[model samples]
Target chain A: MTALAPPRLPTILPLGLARGALELRRFFRSRETVVFTFALPTVLLVLLGSVFGDHAEAQGVTSSQVLAAGMIAAGIMSTTFVSLGTDIAGDRDDGTLKRLRGTPMPAAAYFIGKVVLVAVTTVAQIVVMLTVAVAMFDLSLPDTAGDWLTFAWVFALGVVGCSLLGIAISSLARTARSASAVTQLPYLALQFISGVFVNPITALPTGLVVTASFFPVKWMAQGFRSVFLPDSMAAYEPAGTWELDRVALVLGAWCVIGLVLCLTTFRWRRGQDG
Target chain B: MTDAAISVRGLRKRYRGSRRPAVDGVDLDVARGEVVALLGPNGAGKTTTVEILEGHRDRDDGEVAVLGTDPADGGRTWRARIGVVTQSATDLLELTPAEAVRHFARYYPDPRDPDEVLELVGLADAPRAVVKLSGGQRRRLDVALGIVGRPELLFLDEPTTGFDPQARRDFWRLVRALAAEGTTILLTTHYLEEAEVLADRLTVITDGVVVAEGSPATLAGRQSRPALVGWLEDGRPRTEATATPSALVAALGQHFGGEVPGLSVRRPSLEDVYLELLSAAAPEPALATAGGAR
Candidate 1:
């Protein structure tokens, strides 16, 4: 007689990956998130680059390369801060998180799936944006592998820090519409003062520069500039120094602060006591 | 024989800033393979009690054991043994029905075949896209997901709340099949007909307490209550409420010395008993507690 088959054990990776892929598909299918994450960044990058390319010295940069670096930083900002913030708040408001909490799936597994999807989408956005900058706008690549490595690490850290902050902010929004409005303010204001546009240190008041530096936007842009621009490029700046070490410290601080806030305030249910 | 499917005592929960409790001192028990329904009106603590038992919410003071473990501290094993069908349907728009079911099945140690569950829920023909399914079909998919894990005890929170008549009957068939297969079920619904047809026993809760509990016919001693006999007499409507409907019918026949005109007999139905229970449990709306309502 033939023997019976042995019992099978559950495996979680394929399941996690499948879940992440579906979430990514859902994200892309939503026209609002797509326009904000993909089209909006491309449009903003092009519009800002063209408007100020010829007037570099007046904008505190000798070349367009500095502006390109800042714009790439802006793209990272939008991915981690704006897109993730609104998405978390929307899920909380719609009872999706409450529903998921009832299921048997591990909570960590769900978060890992979200992070995986974010990684894939964020990388794609970076590549598409950089390709457009290089081919259309004559932007140059980083001179060495070390520069690319630095860019990748900074990008990863920036995504984590901003996404955590986004999750934290989601706890404050009462509804999806309010979440959208509340999250956009940071994205717009940070992009302006973090030197994505004209240098805020020169154009804005000193107090604003000092205040914006405490945030992740300025450090991310400074770190991006450390990779793309030449070593002597720091001489032409308002800060007047590269301050590579300071960029690491400031971004590191933002990452810690964001994580703490997320852990403390992130909620699975919509109402305060639900 | 020693294994009770579910047990709870003194289950209490209160929302912040709420003066009254949602689930206050509720005691419940379900034997192995028994199908029990919790029948109550809106604002009853049925959802809160079920959620607490599912380990999704905390209770203030309770001794609860589901599948032989305290739900408040039950970990992965306890969760794997329980299946919960929530009120909201799956809103994952990108995944197909088949894909969603398979994804959820992986979360359990032992899961049923995805195709078999799909067929059971009558979604075999429409497993491609969840976005394409009709309302009934979507609810069927929800059931499929809830049961694909082959849970020992299943909690269905208002499962048929939005179903049409035919769909509701179809869902009853599914519930019966699962119960026959020895899957213990605990359901909550607004449909009295459903409870009358499906539940072996039921408990009626109001204002965070049980006012009545028994078999459908026996609750509030309804089977022994007076029945109504009505007919047309002298072109006018005539009626009497009596303990013996047949006796009243026979008396009418003797008085007329023939069949009574427009003879009809009616008894207190499950809905009647349910309404009476609600009214008796709380005489005024002031007794209606806050939290866990709509």
Candidate 2:
């Protein structure tokens, strides 16, 4: 009998891009995902801004400005961490991941597709948040190029860091329902402790502050706060500073650790413990 | 390239925290271009063995080769030449049959045309969303994706479970078509009729070990079993199992002094022989002491 020749390896980039496009299309098609990712944060921002009013002696700025800046970070976490974590778990439970594993598709290509989806959604969420904040609440963003540069890096790092963590944490969820429920815990807890809901970060207990510092959410909120808030508002934060360098360092570290954890623990099958 | 499309020996696997090994010291081989069915009841190690062959599960101890390559070491190039239809339903609710087929086609080096594959699988006019398709249509979509790559060897794990009669027949026809195209198929099924119709040979397993292996007609010395001869005598039914039903019928004809009344000869069905083989090889309680027993 003659052995059949193996097929040539297909270019991974095109395949990855195709997968990303498919994911984006599916994301947009789902009205629930679109509303949760794009609309909910802006609505929450407006509600909080209206209830708390703009002028606050704590930061010498409107509460809307503080919440809006922090809400962008919260939105990134929701899109990348909460949404992705649940989606991956659902895919695993439904055997989609296993079907993909059976094919010649590379695992990295699948992950690249997920990253692309997160990036696209992140940009859209940021746009909506900023547009609503500026148009409705008179929120002022960064006026200098350097501040914009900081915004870009923080945004990029925040998404990447949270997405990797999402992938890693998804392995712990054996079912789609559990994934949705479990992700909500971190998403809500981070919102409260990371100052997404509160104005003065220093007002929180030291233990809670230290615990929040160990995660990327607080750093991401601080990074965005630095970009959107004026230098005088740094007094509201711990250490009486924005700690921009620490934001970069902490988020960068989480990105590295999250990547390692995901690479080691991600599974194509739902029941696989590893 | 080896003539054997699949070869396994001394295969063993024990699920974590399980008392008995799921697979134990099983051996199997399938010649190139042949359709072989692994037949067993549920939890009889058929899935475990097939998963090992598909490289989806790791075997604890075994020598296995599929298409001349060890599946444990099977890379993307190796994977491209084989297709697998797993037991569980694939959930691609967002994609239409055409879209899914087209997307999977890109993963192969030389995949069949997506439209042609869709037509072949009888999903030419599938619904716009897969979630809207019937169960049979969804299953056909799975088969479409499996064969779109034009794999040389295909592994089908209970492909017809939950299919309607017409759908099952259509799926059998599809399998036959693939086999006619020289694809070697290893299928696992509990349906005796399905195995008889689709497989060129059969491998019967019980309690993680192969108890019988041969063509459907000759498995477990089925051809050697006596045929049952029956007739109507004195307005009452009479039956007898005889080694030579033809000779018995001749004698019965003479006794009747003419054409026999309602005479018929019946051989043992494959299902009967399969059940006997399984019962004969059923594990005794003492066998639990075996090292790999659990």
Interface RMSD values for all candidates = 2.7, 2.0
Instruction: Locate the minimum summed-lDDT window of 10 residues in model 2 chain B.
Output: B285-294
DockQ of each: 0.45, 0.57
Model 2, position A121: C-alpha lDDT score: 89
Candidate 2 lDDT, B137-251, residue by residue in tens: 8888888888888899999999999998999999999999999999999999989999999999999988899999999999988999999899999999999989989999999
Report the Cα lDDT for residue A195, model 1.
76
Find the 10 residues in a row with the least total lDDT in model 1 chain B: B285-294
Model 1 per-residue lDDT tens digits across residues A1-274 = 1134443434457657766876787787767767667777778777777766656553344445567788788787777677777777777766567656656676666666777767777787788788877866666778899988888878877888887787788788877678878888988898888777765345667777777788988888878877877766766445787677787787888889998998898777765546
lDDT of 1 by residue, B51-90 (tens): 8988878889989989888887877666777888877744
Pick by TM-score: which candidate is best? 2
TM (chain A), candidate 1: 0.89
TM-score attained by model 2: 0.93
For residue B257, give model 2's deviation from the true position in Å.
Answer: 8.9
